[model samples]
Target: MAKKAYIGVDGVARKVKKGYIGIGKNVYGPELLSTAGMPFMALANKYYATHYHVDQDGGFATLELDTLVSSPADIIGKWWPDGSFGSDSVETMITSRIRTAVSYSGLIIHTEAYEITEQTVGIARKIRKAYVGVGGVARPCWSGGELVYYGTATALSVARQHLAATSVGNYALFGGGETTNNSNVIDAYDASLTRTNPTTLSAARTQPAGTAAGDYALFAGGYGSNYSSGVDAYDVSLTRTNPTALSAARTQLAGTAAGDYALFAGGYNSRGFSAVVDAYDASLTRTNPTVLSTARCDLAATSVGNYALFGGGQISSSSSSAVVDAYDTGLTRTTPTGLSTTRYQLAATTVEDYALFAGGNASGGYSTVVDAYDASLTRTTPTALSEARYRPAATTVEGYALFAGGFSSGGYSTVVDAYDASLTRTTPTALGEARDQLAGTTVGNFALFAGGYTGSFSNRVDVYMVS
Candidate 1:
């Protein structure tokens, strides 16, 4: 039940002539009880009422529930009472009501008064909420401020291998791979970690390279029944358009974006190893940039600052190469100090100021070397991975570079190694399944490793969330 009441100018409680009663979203008694009358329901179900009384009559009405109720834990953080407090007396009245709301009703509302500046005094402040994680605890400052409703073990719609991953706007996408046959499925995860199947690729091709620039996420070059030069571009809204294809149709190429350009460099074509470098600008304009110094296949690519770097790949079937190629925003090519180890199938990602290239097969044995390049392209060696593995999935989230699930001497690995911004290494929880050839990318606060071969093709998606 609710009563018609408001606070007087003298800070005294008084009954008012007009108001309504409401409970759990339903307005029960009296005149024209609309949505605004149902306070409990309007609070987005955050609190429940054993008994109720609230007032919304005229000058600074307050929440007057019989006994306040809330969850076991207090919703901590700065919050502003909805409307304007015109005078100091009104502010004091509102603070008193908040105290009453917390004291009688058990809701631990923190009514800390912020020092009002010229900017903050007259403006209305928004009520902020947070994302709740597992164990019903809220994780601070994330999108979709609601209870943790999404479930884990989120797998791709199809099982695949040799897939490619990239992110643009609010979504991270995994595209093109081989399953029973070549698959064109593009699985998407949005900011809320909800999965959606966007339009499939125009061509079903294995080992297509994925990257993003401006409003577009692009998948370019790979082998279908034949080598495909087709370039499929998806905008931030997941709307698909075919950009101009690559200069040469190829497979095992590397793709990355720097500044305003998305680039595809070095791959095996029908003509054997090709050194072609194709670039697409923000407007989807295609240009042939200076190619890689060495023609290679299965190279790794990552970007940091204003440059994109492609490093370490099989220069020939019998051996790997340490050749590291870089392209600045202007598409000018430079050969940086190569990786300390001549290796291919290495994985690369960015963390803070460095672009790290980690573990790959070098010689006959798997290599554990980890190399880092700063924004100025200065190279440094970081602490190596706990396990020597090749083809691990790599991505960054919350300043941490995560390398997950690859193959080593003992066979398939479930180990997940992480490196912070300072290059300090730590091992987090392992993947649910041991696999390799999976694709990895970030969306919001999550780093996801999806789809791989675990003896057989697997559709498992392992998510590491920074809460």
Candidate 2:
């Protein structure tokens, strides 16, 4: 049996060598086996011992036995022996003491260079991965750690947690946040998870929010020395441009794409928790929409095909609130089902027509409860995250909604969870570092979490492969 399925180094599954390899069998006796050259594959079966061997050039060789054997195909391998058995045991046994050119013994295994196939490599069911050697030699490379091949393993790029992240097409940019101090650093990650700090933000802003607008991306209000009103915009060419500031500076806000516009809503301003909802057109001009029904900050937001919704946040007095706000493509405001569990500093992401809200701080403490909202805005509670956390990051990657890194009840978390279309939650992998207050976005097939408060505020970026 030939295996066609393989997971490449890029985390993409592929099929290789899509045709059958012909292996014909021929039995060799004493005379034919003595001078057999090149590599030969042999299968010893029960019944009167008949050895079926095929040479590298596909020539057939045979070995006839007088006695009967109990088992068949037990010692199946391709061996390159020089006429003499030397120290070979499986071949030496050859019908229990029946002498062959190789050896005369029992249960002899070919100690010389030999090859095994997927069918006989281990328990017959598992498909063995084959490595095509230099110069076109193909052989099974399984059974754990036999040889090391370059360019066959997955690669890791820098992880930028705690920083705000947004993507367009095949690239994602992470900018600003606390890393040692409130960081001014800005970087970009490509579809392959490669990281490069191509440009700098005009201002150092932490806990900022961003969304893609046309071919460009806008980094809206964040916390600098104080709440920031400055907005930074980057286009397809990575050009840095300025957009008008919000009517008031704010940080920890939730921003999402609404039709062709980007809307930034509820967060803290100098005046306290903000109810201001700022909408920006493609030109980055500001348009104030109806404010959030409930004034709050540290909320999470995500856009469905037609609208954007903001869910869960801290209300006026650092108190967690579970209220939700839905904005139509026209920027009209409507109330949706509140979170089953009241929470703040939560995260949300969408897939198809369903949006999932996960991991936030509730009344008692940090909450691990997860809730999903369908197209009609009905709420369905999914399985909770592996760890209860607050201020984690969320995004859609390869059809799965991912939540990564945050401050959990156990402290800072590096845990990452993925939700499939069925709303089933699975912890596929962990972030490189533990942190929170971060931002996340998707580009191509990847979901990324960047910049967050690890110990004393961090600027780490961690990536996960969802494809």
TM-score of each: 0.72, 0.65
Pairs clashing within candidate 1: 68-105
* Tens digit per residue, CA lDDT, model 1, 1-467: 01123334236455433322222223222222111121322222232222223333323234433222242122111122343433334234434445556444333222222222121111222222223475784433322111121235468999999999999999999999999899899999998778999999998999999999899999998889999998999999999999898999999999998899999999998788888999999999999999899999989999988899999999887998999999999999999999999998889999867999999989968978899999899999999999999988899886678888889988999888888766888888888889989889999877889999998998888888754
Cand. 2 TM to true fold: 0.65
How far residue 452's Cα lies from its native spot in candidate 2, in Å, is 2.8
lDDT for each of the candidates?
Answer: 0.76, 0.66
Question: How many clashes does each candidate structure show, in the order listed?
Answer: 1, 31
lDDT of 2 by residue, 93-204 (tens): 4433332434522222111222222222111121223354757845334212111111111221232344677886667877776654566676777767676665678887
lDDT agreement of model 1 with the native: 0.76
Give residue 444's lDDT in candidate 2 (0 to 100).
Answer: 56
Specify the highest-TM-score model's number: 1
Reference-based lDDT, residue 134, model 2: 54
